[model samples]
Target: MYGIDVITLVSYDQVQHTDEGMLSLSYWTIVGAYTVRGEKNDTGTMVDAVLYDIPSRKMLFRAPGTSRIKGSSTLVNLSEQLRTDSLNGFHLAADNLVTNLQLELDRFRKKVKAMPESYAIEHQPGYTGGGSLEARYALTLLVIGGFALWSSRRKEGFRDKF
Candidate 1:
């Protein structure tokens, strides 16, 4: 919405390690010759992500997060456990990526504003002309008037709740 031409790039990938074997277990109970099968898992997952400002060619952020998941021995399904763990890891990593991107965007705007005009001397995205704030406000007022006229008769209250 601002005057600047903003370009954004994002990418992500997932990595899984099934060779690690069961990561960590919840609990185990043993008495004599009997033992309870606790939650078990054999795979670890992580998410790697990156985002940048294409126009400025500045590296915005990079994030990686590990998924914490446990499979139950009672379930007797290693594949299911791996799937659940991977999904959790992805979700966690996505959160990190989004948060970092937002922060970097704010930083980018401030950094651009503080720099001198010479900083953008070459290699710029195409121009994007737009009407000023006054024009936009006038258009908004026009639409509001049209809506008020169309919504209710002279004697009726406004259609809007407030």
Candidate 2:
């Protein structure tokens, strides 16, 4: 098993489907059919995610996300279209869940900072805190330092020549 300190449980909270009846396509021409129409389907998905400490079984935070998808499909392809739309709705809901989870995590961190006594936090031995400088940032600083040195040397050379 993979080593994990916390576990996240995701569940589908709600699912809704609506049939909007036939939608007319007036602009398109059909060879055999006099009128072209499609059935409108709408699907809504809601997902909930809960974070918990594996060892202590303490609830950390909860996040919820929702999504809605509406599409029109011919009678022949209605089933397949509905299935694809349902999957898309779930995907969108999951994306929203990730965004909400990040926001909740930030709020949780603030809460922990504010009320340190309420939660027990511990770090493993040999744990060190540090800041990381990105490679692009470091390269930019080096280039700036090199440019400044070159400018100063150029000025010095000009003064010596005069």
Candidate 3:
């Protein structure tokens, strides 16, 4: 909505192994399983999608989906896994992409809305220019650490009293 007219699915990459149609599921399950054990996971499907925001000229999100099914020692099992994986991957990637993009957009909106209204550069009031900001920050950290250590020691005796 940020002056965006066209939102395009720039690229859709689906791994060749995903089974989209059960039409060939039976054929492949039998004929394809002969060498399933000999091969290593040639059946699983994976899809990578990139969304392009045309108005902003930015790539919004990339979602990748793949089969989560486990246990495939034989060709039959592997074929089944692949069939499931193909569908699983597409769904997982799409769902993840949408959720991730929503979170990202929310974060972006919060940041933009809360941006400081004005900006000005000015020197620190009591700075004699003896050391840089980095040095001062380091010293501040050391002081805080020392104080914490001192306070923690005081509580050591208090715990024994209870």
Candidate 4:
């Protein structure tokens, strides 16, 4: 059976402060975890992910599409569709996050613009999370690896075919 998982956007950061700069964002998502059993290959699981920018509503990164169909060579239609559906769910979540962040930023800017110069409206150029892009990538890899291992172990002998 085909299933879609809804991923929530947990954390967000506005990386730049120029009038034309974009908002950098990070969040956790779980594309439907899958467990498949078939001839030859017993079981497997996969997780898909995507990263996006809030202000620009742009997709910054996406994990390579993956499916772990170990046995039978032929993929069951439901599993195939699950992959597409999961990706679509992620896209929708990213869009919603952008909309929410944009609305909040716009409101904040309006409030600041209405204030007098005495109330200095200072824009910080950078607000880092202590983790740079490279660090973030490494962290993501760690998370993916952890999950793959966890899922594999959750179901005995479910060799990771990712």
The number of the candidate with the highest lDDT is: 2
List model 2 lDDT by residue over 1-162, tens digit each: 566678989898545464535354442546312334356788889999999998788999999989988777665566787889888999899999999999999999999999999878776565464545678999999999999999999999999998
lDDT (tens digit, per residue) of candidate 1 on 98-159: 67657766875687788856246443365344534577899999999988886666436544
TM-score of each: 0.45, 0.61, 0.38, 0.28
Clash count in backbone of candidate 3: 0
**Model 2 misplacement above 4 A:** 1-5, 13-35, 54-57, 123-162
Residue pairs whose backbone atoms clash in candidate 3: none
For candidate 3, lDDT tens digit of each residue in 1-162? 464443645333455333323233334567645544433343334445556646456664555544443323344465666666556666766666667656766865665467744222244567667555687899999999999999998899789899
* Residue 99 of model 4, lDDT score: 61
For candidate 1, the 10 contiguous residues with the lowest summed lDDT are: 24-33
Give the lDDT of residue 102 in candidate 4: 62
Cα displacement (angstroms), candidate 1, residue 50, comes to: 4.9
Kindly list the per-residue Cα lDDT of model 4 for residues 1-162, writing each as its tens digit. 222122323532221111111111111112211223221332322333454544446543343222233222112334554454445545554565556556655765676578755235333456455535777899999999999998878776554543
TM-score of 3: 0.38
Off by over 4 Å in 3: 1-6, 16-73, 115-162
> Candidate 2, after superposition: displacement of residue 148 in Å?
44
* Alpha-carbon lDDT, every model: 0.55, 0.79, 0.55, 0.42
Pitting candidate 3 against candidate 4, the one with the higher TM-score is 3
Residue 128 displacement in candidate 1 (angstroms): 5.3
Output the worst ten-in-a-row residue range by lDDT, candidate 3. 16-25
